[model samples]
Target chain A: MTAVLEVEDLTVRFYTEEGVVTAVDGLSYRIEAGETFGVVGESGAGKSVAALSVLGLIDSPGRIEGGEVRFEGEDLLSMDESELRSVRGDEVGTVFQDARAALNPVYTVGEQIAETIEHHLGYPPSAARDRAIRLLDRVGIADAETRYSDYPHEFSGGMCQRAAIAMALSCDPELIVADEPTTALDVTVEARILDLLAELADEFDVAVQLVTHDLGVIAGTCDRAMVMYAGEAVETAPIEELYYDPKHPYTAGLMSAIPRVGDDDDRLPTIPGTMPDPIDPPPGCRFHPRCPFAEEACTRTDPALVDPETGEAATLDDDRAAACLEYTEGLSGGLDYSVEVAGGTGEHVEKTIDERDEGGPDE
Target chain B: MSLRRFVVRRALSVVPVLFGVSVITFGLFHLTPGDPVSQLVALNPDVSAAEEARLRERWGLSGPVWRQYLAWLSNVLVGDFGRELRTGRAVSGILWRRLPETIVLGVFGWAFAIAIAIPAGIYAAVNKGRLGDVAARVLALSGVSIPNFWLGLLLILVLSLYLGLFPVLPPSRLPLYHPETLRYLLLPGVTIGTAAAASVTRVMRTSMAEELNEEYVTAARARGLPERTVVFKHVLRNSLVSVVTLAATLTAGIVAGSVVVESVFNWPGLGSEFVRAIDRREVNVVMAITLVTAVAVVLANLLADVLYAVLDPRIRYD
Candidate 1:
């Protein structure tokens, strides 16, 4: 399958009074046509910034320093304002994280959606209004014709998200970048919105770039997942493989942190330390500061993204790649973790590490 | 509540406020150093003591202050604001004659203020941190800092005396729509407008800048709308909600500033008439003008509340 978006060495930086913050450092990923690609990371991991950079929505002080964001083989970075305008809603749409704040409060949701439709699709006002109502109805808004005149505050959080999704789908964009679209929602509503997004993606055959911190969401909705740490992708793999056999220590830590139903562990395992300061990041591997299996080599040398099985540098289309010393056999102190597959293809595996060297009880 | 009900309630609520204002203004003037009777008698030396007493009784100045206030209040309730002591003209008639002029000047000043403020504010906010924004900020600061009367005198000096662009004194007996009348209004209108425009610009700039930072603006831009559309249609519309309140209040302020501006420009408006009446201690005329000004401020606030409801869908009147 052909890729709808090919992001190569994407770098974004923010120039603030404090200093220059490298928000997204040498990030590279791709979304295939008619597939869901997830970018999973903790807060401040630059996931949102990377997504916004794809759409050229980064504001002043935050600059897309370098990289090529080729959408459908067209270089988006080189496009002028007018050209970008034509490509934004017409080709790639974005659904923001906060649904309520994402919608214009003064206008009705119908008017906002219709505005997108009219602008990009060149639909006349009446036709756009009709299309807006139909879109709202398709998104499961009841009595959409009457609700068209209602303002955003009249809708609940879940409803607002649905309306936002409808707006993103207004011009029938080929790709949609949803940044934590369900983070502000409750669990049941999140599920419904996720289901709706998945269904819509299938119906329209659109590529999706789902950015979220929730691994469960990635497991449920995405075909492939890219785990990010400190503005860099630590691992990229198929959903099942990443869940059952994580390669990078950071990815393994993330996988083992999720709570299981039948487990007897009193406390949930957590990755040590927070994200490093972006203004002056640690030298070499960005994750080496918090990584449990870090060696002297990990701190002095940055590892390139490589296929773990083949031990070769991976390209944009690689099926599985991880940036770690163990994959390259350059580590003096090796990762001593073993993955215990729980059961089926979709179940999460537990990573049990030898903790004797770290002062834990010997097992 | 329904819009009609909200409006009626707001209108009904203003009656007590006006009553309190009228009472305070009446008492303050009565209790001040000068006596209206003495001031009038001092001007007319030929009048006998009996004549003075008769005049005092006729004007209801001989009764107890509370009784006099009650008498005046009853007459006002019946739409008889009494007669001016100096001119023997009905106070209501005098107000009716001057009200149009003041309204015209106030409206013109308000329009000028909005015309200058909205664009300047939008420009400053759109080009924040740029040279144009710096210049606009300095202009707004000067506008706010300069006193209206001083600005009026300075304008008259340059535009009237030096440049001969407008008449020093407003042309009398001309209709409001006449070009001559418009030229006459330009100097005073700008003088009063600049003071208010400065404040309006500040408010608009701050509010517009804030709304531009809101997530909806980013969302709108992400939807492929041009920056102009995002700033004007989305950001400006939301920003104007706060600006509406400021604009209405400033419009009322224009009426107040006209009192000083008219004196400097020698323009014939209610402000000048009110100043002259205050100097002569024309209690009836002074009370009438004060009541009118109070009513104007109250009405402007009411209009602001109603506009708030219209502009913000989340605001529901109850």
Candidate 2:
């Protein structure tokens, strides 16, 4: 599949009074045509900043330190203001988290959508108004013709999200970046919104960059997922593989934390500690301080993102890759764990490992 | 609570307010130590006791305070605001003649303030923390700090006295549309407008700065709209709710400033007329002018409420 967007070594920093915050540090990823790529991380992992940097929306004090964000072979980072304007709404539409605030309160939702159409497509007011109504109907808002005149306050939270989605699809953009589109919505509405997003992505043949902190959201909508830790992608793999066979320790910790229906555990397990300060992150592996599988070498060597089976740096085309010392054999003490694979035939294959050798540590 | 009903209710509510204002102003003037008859007699000793008593009877000053207030209130309700004691002219007629002059000055000052404040505010907000913003802050500070009367004196000194760009005293009775009359309006208009513009600029700058940081602004920019579109269409529109409120207050300020400004420029607006009426102890004229000003302040606030509904969709009069 042809890549619609190829982001390489995208770094973003914020010059705050406290110190320089390395928001997105050396992040690299890609989204192919019609694919749904999810970037999942805890808050402050720079998911939103990295996505905004793609559209060149970072304001003052926050700068894109260095990066190559190529959209259809055109370098977006190098584009001037006018050029970026053409790419922003026309080429890549954005759906912000707060749909209510994302819309202008003074203008009708229809007028706002029509404004985008008029600006990018140069459609006349009459034609743009009709197009906006059709777009609104396509996003599942009933009585679109009449609702087009209603202000944003007249729309409910779910309807606002639908309106926002309609707006993003107004110009038939090649890509859509939805930053926590359904976060403000309730659970039932969130499920419907996610389903609608997936349906629209397929229908328009548009690549999507879905940024969220919810792993369940990523699993429900994304075809491939990248797990970011401390502004870096620690693991990226197919959805099923990432969920069932997570390679990195962080990913494993995240998966195990999900509460299954029949489980009777009194307290849910949680990863120890919070995200490190971006201004002064720990040396070597950024996650070493909180990682349960950390070893002496894990504190001394930062592992590169690599194919877990071969121990080599993984390229963009790799289907599965993780960044961990255990994968690269850099850890003197190997990780001791078991794989319980739930087979499709209802059979379970349990592969257990013996304890680490008590001999002197292999340097 | 439709907008029509809401407006009618607000208008109805103004009756008690005006009544309260009229009663207070009338009572304060009457309750003062010196009586109008006594003052008139003292000013002109050639008047005999019979003439003084006749004057008191003519002006209906020989009664209890409440009875006098009720007499005036009844006349006002019937649309005859009584006669000015000093001029023996109908108070309503005097107000009608002077109203336009004050309005002309007030409107010009208001126009000047808005014209200066909106652009200066937008510039300062867009270039926040820059040299332009610094200069705008300093200008606003000076505007708010320096009284309009002082500013009026300075403008007259520099622009009128030194440069001879305008006359020291405006021509007595020229129509407002005449070029000669408009030229006479410049210094006083600028004087009143400058102080208000300074306040408005500061409010606009603050409101614009806050609105620019809103998520909608960021979203608008992300849609590939031009910077000009984002700033003018989205940012400015949102900021107007607050700015409109400040503008209403500035309108009242212009009216108040016109009192001193008109006196200084020798302009024949209601402000100067009101001042002259107060000095002469023409109780009827003073009460009428006070009521007019009270109504003006009330109407300005009403306009602000209406504008609030217009600018913010979430704010319903209902």
Candidate 3:
């Protein structure tokens, strides 16, 4: 079966006055139907830009240089504006970072949802309103009927996100692109919103592209995840596999950086340096500057993403891949790392994977 | 608070503002070099002192300034402005006759301003940095920079003297609402409206450009709304919230512009009469016009607050 969304060699750039900034470069990933795929990156990783490119939402001064965004077997890039628009809110709805900002201040929350229903589904205003009210209620908004007419400011941050989720699901789209849906929320509110998003995605049976910087968020939510660095995907694997036996050193660094609840580590380990400037990145691996395991070859050559286990070039069908000289050209010193999962009360048994020797915990 | 309550509160606030204006205006008029009856017959030395005394007493001006001010304020509260010293006609009666002309000019000026500013502003913003936007901006710059009197004279010279498109003076017999009145109104209306329209256009362009970058605009477009609907149906209303505030200021601006504008066009409006009353020290006419204009402008601001609420749901009086 065709994947719900297929992005191949996607490249996006912004033509600023200073020079061209390649925001997203040669990035590719596939999300299967009813799956949650997380795109994890720092601020300048271009994860959001890649997602926006799928819906043709890149405005002027920023252009989708080249890419093939195939949505359910259709190339969304080649479609006309009108055709693309018809598919956008109907087939692939979007939830943005700032929920209140995403919703228009002047319009009522319910009418905003109904507007999409009326536009794409051919439902009359009254019928659309009824459906929208049902959707708001489904998204856990109590008194959805009375709340439908309330503007965005009247809703709390969490409630605004709920209403946004309702609007995204209003047209019953097959794919929902939620870009950091809980970034603006409080920690207490963040958990509830994320759970609500996961629950709704399951209930609706829709694929979600969850873009976030939090590894914990990806750990608890995603089925498969891709790690992006310097506008490129560095690794891709199943969520559990990536967490336990991460193929990329950057991904391994990310795993260890998360503060564990069971163990009392005063200062958590963190990646050494910041991401390289995107406008002019390092010549070799973008992560080489920060990688503790970087060898001479890593600074000399750029490596393509490949299946580390089989030493073959990575494809959308490949189950696991890592873009590193160790996986392709064979590093002189060899890559060594271990992941230890702390078991709280033995419910989640302590498990460790050391790529070099399968050693028990870190010596 | 509800719209009605908001409106009522705003309306009631106008009272104190008007009273303050009345006191200031009365003080300023009294501070002028001459007494009220001086313009009447003070220059006429052939008249006896007793005649002047009797005239001052009859008009109730033979007292200290504060006593006279209290008298004027009391009379004004009951819709009775004192009699004009020159014509002995009721100040209210004189104002009632001349106010319609000023109202007609002001309405036309505002109509022309709004009609021009809204479209031009939208176009300029939608096509920002394009040739059309540059042209509209240049026009707006010229509109703001040019003085109303100079523009008024230029219009008369070009439209009346050269083109003969309109008569040099407003037709005396034509009713203020007549279609022919529109022809006579063009020069003054454009003159009064040019600066306001220009300022409004700049504001509209800025407000719209800012709003277009708002996340909601992108979200609205993401919803598959057509460009026209996204711009007009969604962004336009948000942009107008700020423009409405500027429009309120422009209301007073248009009314004030009429003083000079009415003189240039030789229209028999309160503005020209107001200038005459000022010269002759017709204190009653001056005070009446000042109070009326202050009240009109204050009410205009009230209307703006209401419009702001209508356009933006977030605004609340409470």
Candidate 4:
């Protein structure tokens, strides 16, 4: 399937007075048409920066040091500001984090949305007004006709987010990049918003790139997931494969950290150590210093992703590789050195390493 | 604030304040050491106490001080500001003649200032560290520092003496009431207006620059709105509350600030008339002018509060 959006080896940096701080480093991903692609990472992992970089929205001092971002076969980086602006609201809509600040306080929400319609769709004033009301109703704003005359401050937080969504959808764009769109909302509101977005994406046949830190959200809502660590994509897999058989240790740690409903006695597992600074990353493998399975080789040399043998599609098989040295075959585990017959290739590798380090398992 | 509540609250609040001001101004004029009766007799020499008393009573100075103040305040409340002491003309008639000229100079000056300052501020803010930003900052700094009165004199010397625009002094009995000579008001109008504009522009630029950095503006751009729309529409209006508040106060500032400018050009507005009244110690005229100015300031502030409620919905009367 052809990708609707393709980003390759993207690196973003800010040249501050102190030094250049790398915000996003060599991250790559592809989103196919009509798919919900999720980028999951903790705060400061550069998920929002990557999203902003796609729209050419990064200001001075923060520069796209390297990469190619192509949307429907067009190089977004090569386009001038005017050309880029034409594509921004017309072709790609954005639902920002805070809905309240996103809408202007002075004007009515309908008027603001109508402005977008008029700017992109060339509708006359009266038609634009009608279209704005329709869009607001579609977002579930009640009394759409009379509410059109009300200012933004009159609406509640959830209502403001709805208004923001209405404004975004005014131009009927092909893609929507929502950066933590539901973070500031309560859980009930969050569920409704996600459902609304999923329904809208399906109905409109538009692709979505949802950026969030919630592992459960990505697992439940996204078709595919990409885990970002220290500004790099460590793993990308189908959501089912990612949840049930997470390959990367970081992904495994993330899954173990999720609070299962009835498991109240024991604490949820958490990875130790704060998120590393991106300005000057730890040498060799960026995750080595924090990885529990780190060996001498893991610290001395970086490991590139390799296709795991229990593979799916050819494209996905290559896509699921992890940057861990233990994933390599024959280097640390072999027949003469290995004693126990493990159940699968991945289990065999983990057992052999565990046995070697612990001397022997209990009888 | 509700429209009715706002209007009534503002109207009621200003009444007692103006009454108190009238009393103080009336008392101060009477308390001054020099005797206005002696000054008037000395000037004319043939006038007696009977003539002085007639002049006083004509200007409504015949009653006790408190009674006179109450009478004047009540007259003003009923839209009758009595008559001028020297000319025996209605005060409202005088204001009708001079208020428009003051407003004309003020509006045009403020418009010019907003035009220059907004773009300059945006340019400086957008190009924060570049040469253009530095140039704009320097210009704004100078605008804030330079006195408007001094600038008015400089404009007179440069534009009037060298360029020989209209006469240094505006035409006596300005033909503003007529249509044919309207353009003649341009130079004097510009002189006063530009001085006020320079200060207002600096204010707008500072406010605009600060507001451009707010997260809402960033949010607007992140939504894929054009850069210009984000700056001009989103950030500009949010930032303008301060600018408007400052501009509202300018009605009073320009009136007060225009004293030197008006005197320099002999524009025959209240400011120039005020300087003459003070010098001659025309107690009744001075008290009348002070009362009028105090009312103008109080009314301007009241208008500003209403405009504030209209421009920003977040403010409430409760």
Q: Report backbone clashes per prediction.
A: 0, 0, 0, 0
- Taken over the whole model, the C-alpha lDDT of each candidate is 0.89, 0.88, 0.88, 0.75
Taking all chains together, the TM-score of candidate 1 against the true structure is 0.94
- On TM-score, the leading prediction is 3
* Pairs in clash, predicted candidate 3: none
TM-score of 2: 0.95
Off by over 4 Å in 3: A344-363
Candidate 4 regions with alpha-carbon error over 4 angstroms: A265-268, A308-318, A328-363, B1-35, B38-64, B77-101, B162-166, B170-174, B177-191, B222-224, B315-318
DockQ of each: 0.84, 0.80, 0.80, 0.49
**Model 4 C-alpha lDDT per residue in residues B5-99, reported as the tens digit of each score:** 87788789988897788778778877776555566667897898799888767667667867877786687667676665456667667666766
* CA error at residue A132 for candidate 1, angstroms: 1.1
Cα lDDT for residue A319, candidate 4: 51
Residue A108 C-alpha lDDT in model 3: 89
Docking level for model 2: medium
In the order shown, the chain A TM-scores of the predictions are: 0.94, 0.94, 0.95, 0.88
What DockQ class does candidate 3 belong to? high
lDDT of 1 by residue, A1-363 (tens): 999999999999999999999999999898999899999999999999999999899999999999999999998998988999898888898999998999999899999999999999899999999999999999999999999988898899999999999999989888999999999999999999999999999998999999999998999999998999889999999999898778888998998899877889999999989999999999889998888778777778889899987889989999799999777864655677777777666676566543235442112
Instruction: Give per-residue lDDT, candidate 1, residue B31.
Output: 86
**Order of the predicted models by TM-score, top scorer first:** 3, 2, 1, 4
